[model samples]
Target chain A: MSEHDKNTRHLARMQRKKAVVDTKIESAKISKGLLLIHTGIGKGKSTAAFGLLARALGHGMQAVVVQFIKGRSDTGEEAFFKNAANLQWHVMGDGFTWETQNAENDLASARKAWDLVQACLQDETVNLLILDEFTYALKYGWLSIDEVVAALKNRPPMQHVVITGRAAPQALIDVADTVSEVNLLKHAFQAGVQAMPGVEW
Target chain B: MSEHDKNTRHLARMQRKKAVVDTKIESAKISKGLLLIHTGIGKGKSTAAFGLLARALGHGMQAVVVQFIKGRSDTGEEAFFKNAANLQWHVMGDGFTWETQNAENDLASARKAWDLVQACLQDETVNLLILDEFTYALKYGWLSIDEVVAALKNRPPMQHVVITGRAAPQALIDVADTVSEVNLLKHAFQAGVQAMPGVEW
Candidate 1:
């Protein structure tokens, strides 16, 4: 096609797309807190949650993060956001499930983290709460899905909650307002590349 | 099963898992720069890139962000990171394709952004470069995929590059060390919930 003809066709296509998008944007009129779930056996579930935490912090919102599966306190994210006045971070797990190797201990730790989450749910001042690797707790039956869903349903009206991990339960997905499955197509580790600091940790 | 028996079984299972995971971690000994692509139709593609930017900055690594399809300079991330000492962010597009409605203008903007990207790729001082919404440029044929791939291949040895957008080209994915497809299972906007500041921005 000629350049002018191509440009005209492009303009027409864009106009159509614009109209559809505009209608969608216009239809979305209700504003409220959202429960978002990031799941699947892929990277960036927690990373994306950390990104939301950054955005929340950038906007001067109070944020809380509860690490349910990751036990390490020396992660790059923790080190960076530890001193932020608007942020509260709690690393509750002793380690990964394999490293811990005790069902009772894991359950206890999950319970402790849930206690804190319950408090955050009631605290309207907390704008964003990230439950990192939380799906594992539900998947492994360390926490009761019914109770968790109940608390999420009753969270402060303007408080947003983000849960991240692989294989999120159907119950949680049913309650969540937004759900994104991060599918791993390929990984560097499979090609013998080590996970580097800051980018991976 | 009895609690004691359950505990014993869990321990055995964890031990087996630990052995497998340890083997994988041991095999991955090489450390190098990674090329990661976040694609598919879902939320957090750019948000996850921003998260990586945060992590890079947290570690005091020099970072650069070249937004290919987002023209607005008033995003929460930009507002927050504009003053950071080790970061440079460039928003090159006039707007979304539909909003702009001009192929020539969009192509010109993409070319201009690619120029900056090429410079960053050669600069070893830049530890991380986020090309947000960059897949669109490639998908629309605004830039040559061969040239982009060559530049990425020849980038600084220790510099990590992340490209985020929907439907990343096969050529780009082929060169990427890690690829994550963010699938949209559910969205708040679909349920008539408006996008809010910080969380959705």
Candidate 2:
């Protein structure tokens, strides 16, 4: 087809698409907050959550992050965002469950982190809350999934929550407004590539 | 089993894991660079790339971004990273191909963007290069896959490259050290949730 004809057809198609998209956008009127879940056996779940925190901060929104399974406070995200005045950071886990070596200790740490997250949920000023690696806590039975879901449902009306980890529970998935599963296609670490400092952490 | 016994078993398991992880880390001595590809129908491919850029910047590394299929500069990532001293940002595409309506114009824009990316690839100081939504250009025949692969192979030894989009070509996947497919388990947009600012820009 000639360029002009092609262009005219494309414009017509887009006009049809615009009508549909505009109607959808207009129909979506309930925008108080969102419960977003990122999970699966992939590498970018937590990284995606951190990106959202950056996005929220760009809009001058207050964000609070509570890490549930990672013990270290020196991740690349922490190195930069911990100093942000609008962010409240908490790294409360002892480590991975197998590394912690005690179920009671892991449970206690999870409980403590949840307490902090609850406070953040109650804070009217905190616009976004990130529960990093939280699904691990639920999967390991470190925290009650029912209680967590209840609390999330009862959070401030305008507070957005992002939960990131692997193997999210069906209950959590059901309650989420958006959910993404990042699947692993290939990994360098599997092929003898060590995790690089800035890239992995 | 008693709590102490369970704890002891956990410690032993972790010790074994530590030894294995340490040996793997030690064996991975060569660190030239990484060709990481994030492609799928899921939501976090570009977000994950942005997170990597943030991580690189946290380590004081320079990054250059060439957006291949998106034209809008009002994204949250652009709003934040464009001002960063270490980042060289380029929004080169004329928007999505369907939106642009002219294949010649789209091909010309893609070629221009590739030229800019080639310059960045040659620059030793650019530690990270992000080609956002680049796979579309190759898939649409706007650019040559062989030439893109050859240029990537010849990039600076220590410069990392991240390519993000859905349906990445097999050739690109073969050359990449890491590849992740972000599968769409569920999307809010499909459920009548409109894309919100700062969350889906």
Output the number of the TM-score-best candidate.
Answer: 1
Q: How far out, in Å, is residue B15 in model 2?
A: 3.2
Model 2: interface root-mean-square deviation in Å: 2.1
Q: How well does each candidate superpose onto the true structure, as a TM-score?
A: 0.97, 0.93
Candidate 2 deviant stretches above 4 angstroms: A1-23
Instruction: Give per-residue lDDT, candidate 1, residue A1.
Output: 91
Candidate 1: the clashing residue pairs are none
DockQ of 1: 0.76
Interface RMSD of every candidate?
A: 1.2, 2.1
Question: Lowest-scoring 10 consecutive residues by lDDT in candidate 1 chain B?
Answer: B72-81
- Residue A179 alpha-carbon offset, candidate 1, angstroms: 0.4
lDDT of 2 by residue, A1-201 (tens): 987887687678767776776687788766567888889887888888887877777777888889898998767778866677688888989887556657788889899998898888788888889999999889878789899999999989888899999999999999888889988888888787778766788
